[model samples]
Target: MSPTDTDALADDLLAYIDASPTPYHAVRETARRLEQAGYRALDERESWTLKPGERVYVTRGDTSIAAFHLGTAPVDRAGFRLVGSHTDSPNLRLKPNAQVAKNGYQQLGVEIYGGVLLHTWTDRDLSLAGRVVLLEGGKPRGHLVDFRKPLLRVPNLAIHLNRGVNTEGLKLNPQEQMVPVLGLESAGAVDLRAMLVKELSKGGVKAEAADILGYDLCLYDLQPSTRSGAHEEFLHAPRLDNLASCHSSLTALLTGPASREATSGVILFDHEEVGSRSAQGAASPFLRTLLERLTLVLSDGKPDAFHRAMAQSFLVSADMAHAVHPNYASLHEPKHQPQMGAGPVIKSNVNQSYATDGESWAYFAALCREAGVTPQHFVTRTDLGCGSTIGPITAGQLGIRTVDVGNPMLSMHSIREMACASDVAAMVAVLRRLFA
Candidate 1:
């Protein structure tokens, strides 16, 4: 890809990361894009009558989404070409009893959601965004909220108070040190539920404190994603670990040519950062249920057609890969060090952390070669522990041939992460070829 194409794609990726503060928001943004591209939404509770060349999508719990375009050939003859990615990232989530006041200061109690770099969260401007459930006519309803302003902050203790912070490293307790200061209590007690009701009213959603049945809110940095570096080759953003892959895969699905030989699709699952056990996660039956329904509809209830389609299907599990850190070069495998600005990476693990095998690896590498791009390889060092993706779990569930691949990045679980701008375009190009 040329510099102009790379810069354009990087700009789009940054916008996506900035817009998506939570998994619910990510799915909503993706659904917006898919709908703009003429894909219609299908309700799972209702009957679906699908036809060839039809573009359709289905959502589960408003967090996970699967979109597909039927091909000209029968599904049993031409199986699915699928790209998978996750929507969740490591962050702080608000607890049920979140309101707490100490020494005339009000704070929100939070629970760490996943493996987070706790220190990075200190001394940052934070805001709240997620879904809140409200009661309406004796039923619970959900509404998306985005407090776009800096409503809270987690300040770091001064250096003078902790003199050995630099050399000895700073340690924080999630229960005590991680609570964010919302404001000061002036008069009497501050009712947190009433405060939420006021905020919702400002956003044009009328509700009372009694109407709030539940919520799933999280705190996020207020900083906007941007392109940095001398040549603008570096991109810095939040939630890039999996959202970058999600954006690339969605773009590829929308831009790729409608194939006559395969049914092309993309799935963005939720809850991967926290072990993917939810109804919308990869460990659940969401993907398999959709695939079976599609097969049954396409084959007119033919016997064994779903299994036949699975036999010929292929899945490319896309997640962010660890790039060789400049400050810690010795941490990576010597020969298989993936570099920023390099092309996509093909990841493998012998212990089944990733699903890449010889056959699938060769298949993906050939796709990259056909796209005129060089593919990199990644394997964790023998002495170190390896992080996992949804690749292996999804493959085991469906018995489909799967390959793990992604763009190289740094700061895997930090609040703000970095990546090469050029790699975004490269991965999108390879995925476009795969979908075509």
Candidate 2:
């Protein structure tokens, strides 16, 4: 790709990440892109009449999305070429009774959502964005909300209070230390619900505090994604771990040549950070059910058609990989150090943590070669445990050949993660080739 093309792709990715402050927003953003590409949205509650050469997508709980392009051939014979990623990231989620007061200051109670880098979240300009469940027209409804500006902040303890801070490292108590200050008590005891109602009204979403039954709000850094470094080669942003993969997969699906044989699809599941167990998660039957329905529809209800398709299907679970950290070089496997800007990483694990085996690895390696990209490899050190992706979970659930891969980056779960701007286009090229 040319430098201009690379910069454009990176810019679009940063915009996507910035727009998606929560899982609901991420899926909505994905849906918008897909719709612009002529992919029609399908209602799960309504009957689907799918046909070959048709492009359609469906969302579950406004958080997870599945988009696919039907092949010109029989789905059972063509099988599915699918890429998967997650919508959620490690962060702080608000509790049920999120309001709390301490030492003349008001704060929101939060619980750690995943393997978050607790210390990184301190002293950042934080805002709230998520789906709010409300009672409208005598029925429960959900609306997306974003307090776009900095509405909350978690202040760090001064160094003077802890002299051994650098040596002992920062220790945080989620229940106590992580509460983000909204304002001082002198500002008056502001009702959290009332604040939401006011914010909703500002967004033109009419709702009263009494109408808001509940919410799934979470705190996010208010920083915009940026391309840093001397050559502007580095992408500094939040939620790159999986959002980068999500954007790449979606771009490939939309831009790739229309498949004449295999069915191409991308499913961005929610709740991967906490474990893929939700209804729209990879561990659930969302993908399988969709595939089975497509087979039945395309094959005219042929017996065992879903099974036949599964036998030939392949899944590329695209989550961000760990680029060898500059400060912690010894933590990585010596022979398999994935570097930022090197290329996409083919992540592997013997214990099935990543679902990449010999067959799948060879398949993906060949795909990368076809796209003129040099694929890198990653494996956690033997003595240390490996973190997983949706690869193993989806593979086990659907019984499809799966390879786990991603663009490598530093700061896997930090509030802000860094990745190569070029790798975004590289991964897109390979994925588009796979779709082809």
lDDT of 1: 0.91
lDDT of 1 by residue, 252-340 (tens): 88888755458899999999999999899999999999999999888646798999999989999999999999899899999899999
What is the total number of backbone clashes in candidate 2? 0
Q: Candidate 2: where is the Cα deviation over 4 Å?
A: 1-4
Candidate 1 residue pairs that clash: none
Q: In model 1, how large is the Cα lDDT of residue 163?
A: 97
For all predicted structures, in order, the TM-scores are 0.97, 0.98
Model 2, position 296, has a per-residue lDDT of: 84
User: Candidate 2, residue 56: CA error in Å?
Assistant: 0.5
Instruction: Estimate candidate 2's RMSD in Å.
Output: 1.3
Q: Residue 375 CA error for candidate 1 (Å)?
A: 0.6
**What TM value does model 2 have?**
0.98
Tell how far residue 125 is off in model 2, in angstroms: 0.5
